[model samples]
Target: MNKSVALTGNEAVATAMKQIEPDVVAAYPITPQTDIVQYFSTFVADGQVKTEFVTVESEHSAMSATIGASAAGARAMTATSSQGLALMWEVVYIASSFRLPIVMPVVNRALSGPINIHCDHSDSMGARDSGWIQLYSEDAQEAYDNVIQAIRIAEHPDVLLPVMVMQDGFVISHAMQNLEILDDESVKKFVGTYKPDHHLLDVKHPMTVGSLFLPNFYFEAKKQEAEALERAKKVIQEVAKEYAAISGRQYGFFETYRLEDAEVAVIALNSTAGTVRGLVDEYRAKGLRVGALKPRVFRPLPHEELVVALQHLKAIAVMDRAESFSTHGGPLFNDLRSVLYESKERPVVTNYIYGLGGRDLTLDELRRVFDETLEAARAGYYRNRVTHLGVRE
Candidate 1:
């Protein structure tokens, strides 16, 4: 039987990493995400997990160490948040392009300028097009569960890519909860052993980890990476289904809340999606036909899943915490518009920029955005400007 125990979101992530039994845990303590690394460090100290824990001086070095461990045919894991992610931007690309299958837990936070340490998606948003599969978790449980699924998705030979498992900073990472920690033996069997088909240390024959390729060969290889990502859809779905069968927990590309016959829908990511879900429940009780769509898989972007979800709605309002700099759009809004543009019949979609600088969004603002999106749908072509939520002059 499955066991349930109270756990902070950061602890839950660390627990899940232990369950996976990675051969190497390379990390540097960064705010918000530090607890996760701490939990893992203790797991090592207590000898619960038999893995080499590498302590690094900086986030960049942490990733560099992970890359080296991964190249040497070990399952590697790491965690970071905000500017820490920004610091590792260079190798973050190399980690994906080289198809290293590293699993990173990013505690979502606002980027620095005036110096803020709160929940926002600016960091991850900056790296959306960086060729890594991104998964946003709604709560601590999904954060724990998806990190395990990330390993399966990234390590699949047909879909060799790194994965970013994002959870809202204080909302999930620092929050406490009763988390059902999976059994170690079961986890070992599920994740299986670290048997890499290609490794730098393999001596059966000579091999290479990463080699520079000229433009002619690089283009085709990059094209192949796209094909690998496409293959990941199947791998991701199948693994989730199999995991559900064993754990009685179900997951999907995107979660729909009362979307079936709704006329308008609100879209969001991370813990904000949970806030929106509660709002959906409140609106549904009052007979308002508003729905919520929380995307789980972002790197693959779940375009097909999103297209299907949009078919029934007349209008959709997308809430984003990160801005795209003068596009009059957010990262998610821009991508969704492009997807719908490719479709023959697409619903009128409106973009709303909210919760910037970690501004707290209340129930009242959510209701207003939903109501305005519905009104704009009937009025034809709404404002494309960022609708700042809870902003003050």
Candidate 2:
């Protein structure tokens, strides 16, 4: 059974964490993401959940504690934003390399230098290669749903990697939205219990974690980790199918809206997808052959599926919320273009970097992007391969 609720994205995620009721939650406070752990800690204090909430000194300590708990065979979880994630960079890799299936909800914020606190993919996109499975949510509903599914995905035997669920800071994180939530028992049944086959506590095994992997074994160990991520694609789909059966909402690698017969489309992630979806319908009503693609799972980069879905389009504009500073284009654009290179008839793809430091992406700017994409479709090539949207010149 489902219950209709009005809650902020952070509240929804905290509520989900309360339902999952993991063995341990080790976290430090950071803007936007602070409320998630704050709310969960209250759940622990109130005795609603018997979770061991560790109040760590720093984000690094938070992840370190989580890694320790996960290594000790406890179902561990954590949450962070921007600098907090960057601070945990070292342990973030270790968590995955150690095969700890810890789940985290990251409220995406711009990485500091200018010291801005707002929505941007820079935080999560910066750690794209750290071996954590990444799931980006469009709004509060998806954020809540992804967190629940993350537990199952991370704990899968074949893909024992940490998972991070991302929602745009202050945008989706603070905005209140109406969303459907599964009953507590239903979520518990869906996620099940986390039972690892091996852990530090297993006296019979007596295996050591975080042991030095020298030249002889490091390569093979890394190869195995890479293989596990590849295996996760299938496991993710399987879990989505089961989740859909229970939740009545179907999920996939990337969602396509009016894309089947469209000649041009815009691809985006996070909250911007909602804007694109609305624009897609408006464009369609005007008899324009336009569509949208929202990538749900970013890491493990579903290239093969994306290629098949996009190969037919004449042009595409990939809206990136973070700049990769590659001098070529944003991170999503670079990866997407590289993948499409394998297609027989490649689409004229362009990159549009937007919404950095929580800057608003107005509907007018999006309309222009779609218009440019449509123009490129007819022109057979775009004037500029890379573009910055909504930026002050």
Each candidate: what lDDT? Answer: 0.86, 0.95
In candidate 2, stretches whose alpha carbon ends up further than 4 angstroms from where it belongs are: none
**How many residue pairs of model 1 clash at the backbone?**
2
Q: Which residue pairs overlap in candidate 2's backbone? A: none
Q: Give the number of the best model, judged by lDDT.
A: 2
In candidate 2, where is summed lDDT lowest over 10 consecutive residues? Answer: 202-211
Please, what are the lDDT tens digits per residue for candidate 2 over residues 1-393?
Answer: 999999999999999999999999999999999899889999999999999999999999999999999999999999999999999999999999998999999999999979999999999999999999999999999999999999999999999999999999999899999999999999999999888899989898998888899999999988988998999999899999999998998899989999999999999999999999999999999999998999999998999999999999999999999988888999999999999999999999999999999999999999999999999999999988988999988
Candidate with the greatest TM-score versus the true structure: 2
Which digits, one per residue and each the tens of the lDDT, describe model 1 over residues 313-366? 777888888988866688898888777775666778888888877788888988
Residue 299's lDDT in candidate 2: 90
